[model samples]
Target: MEQLFSHGISDSISDSIPQQLYRPEQVRHMEAEAAARAGVDMWTLMQRAGAAGWTCLEQHASAEDQIAVLCGPGNNGGDGYIVAALAKEAGWQVRLFASAEPKTTDAQRALQQWLDADGEVEPLLDWPESEPDWIVDALLGTGIDSDLRGDIRECVEGVNEAKLSVLALDIPTGLHGDTGCALGDAIIADHTVTFVAVKRGLCTGAATAYRGKLWFADLGIQREFRLLTEPAAWHLQQDQLGQWLSPRPAHSHKGQHGHVLIVGGSQGMAGAVRLAGTAALRAGAGKVTVICEPGQEFLVGQQAELMVLGLEPEDPRVAELIEQATVFAMGPGLGRQDWGQRWWNWYLQGLERSDPQLELPTVLDADALNWLAESALELSSRNHWVLTPHPGEASRLLDCDGSDIEANRWLAAQTLQEQFGGVVVLKGAGSLICGSEGTAVSPFGCAAMASAGMGDVLTGMISALMGQAGALNITTEDSVRAAVMAHGLAGEAAAQALRPGTSRGLLASDLFPWIVHWINPNDS
Candidate 1:
């Protein structure tokens, strides 16, 4: 959204990486031509890439450090050769391994340069007896997506067994450059220094395990590269918060912020609606009302701020409150029983009868998404809602297996938004938000977020932000992004405080204070 670093960028992209994310093919097709337009050739760009890789290697190594470099047969291998030669010149003990002899002219020249520098290459099968301080993976950069095979697969296996900290250049070998899925096997790197541009693969899906602590080096062609192509998606940034939220006017009242109506908290699952309601309050909703089963009021309304009305589907008060609500957050603990089903139908009928131009802003999550999938009701013309679904829910909505959704999350998110009008938040490791404004990925969440009730909290946060969109002076898409970012930041903060380096015991409610902290971007 707001590109604070957009202005006054330094010559090197490393100083300020652009938020734009590109598919690997975009970089591959445009990079050479873009470099030429910028008055640089492909070989020179390779050298700069090698130098950048050398710099990253230096961060994890020192002179005399034993570093093993794995080179491929193409340009990726050429970059590896250049890095090995520079390491040798810097007095580092370099052990270079190649799956095959350099094939391309540029790679052939690079190999000769390394030979002239007196560096020897070993066969791929020669596993080093001695462990090195760091292993440099320069093999298979954005080249393959089918599956790993032959010596390359064996090499990937060997490197993984070594378990040394790895610095992967461009991308981890075997990771699909576009889908982020492993071809067959992928190198697990501790740090990956991607060159030219940030590949969409590096930020989400299975790549999360193989590509760790990502670093980007634009290789001086980013300006030209960006001019050559448009980004397919955006990597979420904290600075984007400033673009979505601001301080409230000093004389503002609670009613001015907007009201959020939270539906569904069946018998034993009243906690879901409670969590959603409380999260709405914590996230700055002016007022929150939880509509649950007739007897769950005490459990749902225990939080003083939440006005809980435990009523049946036919209760007239339900219609009255629904009419007054500025936004609706449906699902959460809404069960699949007759009671929950009746409420679902009630809401659907209201939406069906409402004017298309003035449809209330809504958030569909948890059991609500499940019910929506079951109903198969098409609301493709309404664009005032948000659907937040996990892989399972998305799979249900798309009529596919959950693994298919995870295999290519970008496609899943896009398809969901296309099939179901309005924003779609595909929640997981690299949560993706797709809408009319294009897709954005929030890479800020933690594994601790794997627990239950997290999605409910996110539903509440989204609803709160949506209700406040008018006052915040941002679009519905901006509101969704802001809520997702804040939710992720809160989870990260809570996980760090509770378990430091591991994600073990963080709870859904633990994020309340942090949600308040992040929701108010100006204060933080």
Candidate 2:
């Protein structure tokens, strides 16, 4: 199967906020309110909604195809009746399977309309007797509050057994619209055409399997409706990154950018430091210096344009260099040896005593993050820092099992941010960047970036962005937002250039050219 990323969706469409995300109850209320505001009858919205659904069906299926419309007792079933009527009118073979009689006036009227059109209406238990090209699930919508059992369970099982393409209305029946939790046996849809607003459950958790090929259609709601409700979550998109990236000027010089100092690389681990230093430079840092073990200085200088500083594993001069740099990238190859521990402790102490107004933004990764977690150092005091951790590292930092972290990546990222008092980048499939006020999930990037040294490059790239002269002038939130987006975009470009299967071999060093390429794609 072709990866979804290969679909080549441009940044423009991806940048648009998903039409609207609403809780199940909230959507029901919105429908009532929108109906009142439209100065039309309550049935008008349902009619329009069903019409929109039928339009989608027309586009998705052919006129000669046979479709089974499954209806329940509520307004959702009313929509299904309307869909059946439309499909019949379009000269398509359509059958109706009702789980129960219409309970609402609109639904009753729709059922009468279907009868008036001479459509087939039979019990849902008869689904096995009929053969249809597609199954339209309208058995339940956002209003489902109880577990699906009895006939509904058997109906769902029968639908699945048929192995026909299914289209769910609003939401897959028996899945919580607010929590993404499945209620008994939920219908697994191949396509879900949601109306008015998107349900939060559709985007996360186990709901991913049930709500496939998600599509949202707004029933002409005004944009001002958004002002009435607070957004519970946000999606990170590529164009949003433009707000954070610094637009370059023709006269801009390297000195006009900011300086970054990368501190790490214990004995025999020079490649990590080289990767970090080169990444920082590639990410647009004007000046970068690598302060590593004396034995690794030659290797650092050979691979990167960065100025390499030869220092003993526990050198005190490292503090002076750190104080001078606009941003610090720490960890990478920093080992767990006693010398590395001593240097790490001294670095934290330096951060504690550093001039409050002159403190530089620091990014902790790999060993530095592990040391912080082990020492239980009060990280909240170091407000200008970012922590990048994979699942194992995050589990240690949060004192939780790795399974706990994977179970809810968003919650884990938030917990780490609240505990550590810095931007927390939870590196994994669907990487999350959480801060004090908000969280952003990178929809790009793949398992291709799963190789060693990737986190080192990420730390360096973020540090460079934070240290950039333009970034220093922005708000802290803005700086962190830009850095996170840039890092993901660079990773995405690199992964795309080297096909998906070949991504594991991708090194942190490979990200540099791609970072430069993405930051200035037109720069030749």
Candidate 3:
């Protein structure tokens, strides 16, 4: 935490968000208690919040800029009242729109302060006569659990229609603070400056699209609050991942690092496994081997650096492969055909030696997920596996529709873990890694991953990280989270590099160089 009173805050507010994510309910439960403990009154806290928001706006707009301030009935509205007063005092052309009278004492006090300052409040019917340069959405805070109402919905629509640069306070109206799902119409702000704590919804689902650029202002009460509950998830950033990254020693050899075997590429669909193999190698796997179906060896082994072999029951090397590799990535081009199924069963059986506990780092993705669903293989406990599923594949695994998996991605990831007994990565806008460490979400998503082979690349990255985690001196949980951040960062990089003019269109292979670059940025 840095000093909130100094210009150091300017950089902090514009450039970064807090590391912890809190649910709205959680913040509500703690705010008053936290404020009281800090000897700060509700009015004082509201003043700080209002000041923080106003400071953010002032950076983008000057006294000459025309601005509109929207206020509701709650404390959020109080913040708006203060902002209006501040703007009015600063000689900016400002308009205040009130949906309802101040309902709380703090809000009433702030409204009276604005009135004393000779700030005029207008009805929330339409925009001001002069087109405002910006709009501040302080209408609804984080507590909204359901859909917007008649007047609120209309006001939200008006704000959206205004289309001017808008700064949303706390959260945008109509966006559920916990789930990030827009109940009806949500405010599409040009910037959102969240206060105190970040809500889980802002980092996941549909919320990511409307959230624009996010900034955080903690309101200078860092030590006053302690987390009473665990966060819904942790958000990982690209640059922060470097702390977990260490360069390979010059004396290090292939034997010291980990060997990763990619099992898949059944029959005609060899591209997927090939991508996964190359990704594993790029991601720092000491040695990568592709176990493809018969006659597909050459296709999967396109790179001389990777060893490719077809699975043969008669081949001794084929039987020993599962036991020999440090980690297994089972999926990608794997079909639900007999050949794929046989290999899946063979690997599972091969790993169950003297130890009763099923402990092997494996990532199940693509067609491997389909086979798991088809067979309905029930495991008694966790087998040290990671299941990477996009919404469609998640539905198949959960025996539900794609909509159900997406409806609540967090719940879906949790339910999958309970059923399948492993870490579950629900791949989407906010890719989640659910394990014993709880769920960590990477809210940063790249449009490039929308392409076909993106999942394959992710699978390879996760598997390779898991394979080499020992040499890296990182935990599986940390490795998984780091891999996710790296993958998304790579995708975002590829998207930017491939389409600097406009962001669209990407192949799976586009991320290969990025994977290598992120793992070893010194080379780049």
TM-score, per-candidate, Cα-based = 0.95, 0.79, 0.92
Q: In model 1, what lDDT does residue 242 have?
A: 75
- Put down candidate 1 lDDT per residue, 317-415, tens digits, no spaces: 876787789998889899998879998888677677774423789999988888889766654445888999999999999999999998899999999
- How accurate locally is residue 484 in candidate 2, as Cα lDDT from 0 to 100? 60
lDDT of 3 by residue, 172-278 (tens): 88888877778777999877888777887888777887777788877655556644456667777666677677777879898776788888898888999999888
RMSD of candidates 1 onward, in order: 4.5, 6.3, 3.4
Model 1's TM-score against the true structure: 0.95
> What overall lDDT goes with each candidate model?
0.86, 0.74, 0.80
Tens digits of per-residue lDDT for model 2, 352-382: 6665523667888999988988876564445
Candidate 1 backbone overlaps, count: 0
How big is the positional error of residue 7 in model 2, measured in Å on the Cα after superposition? 27
* Rank list by lDDT: 1, 3, 2
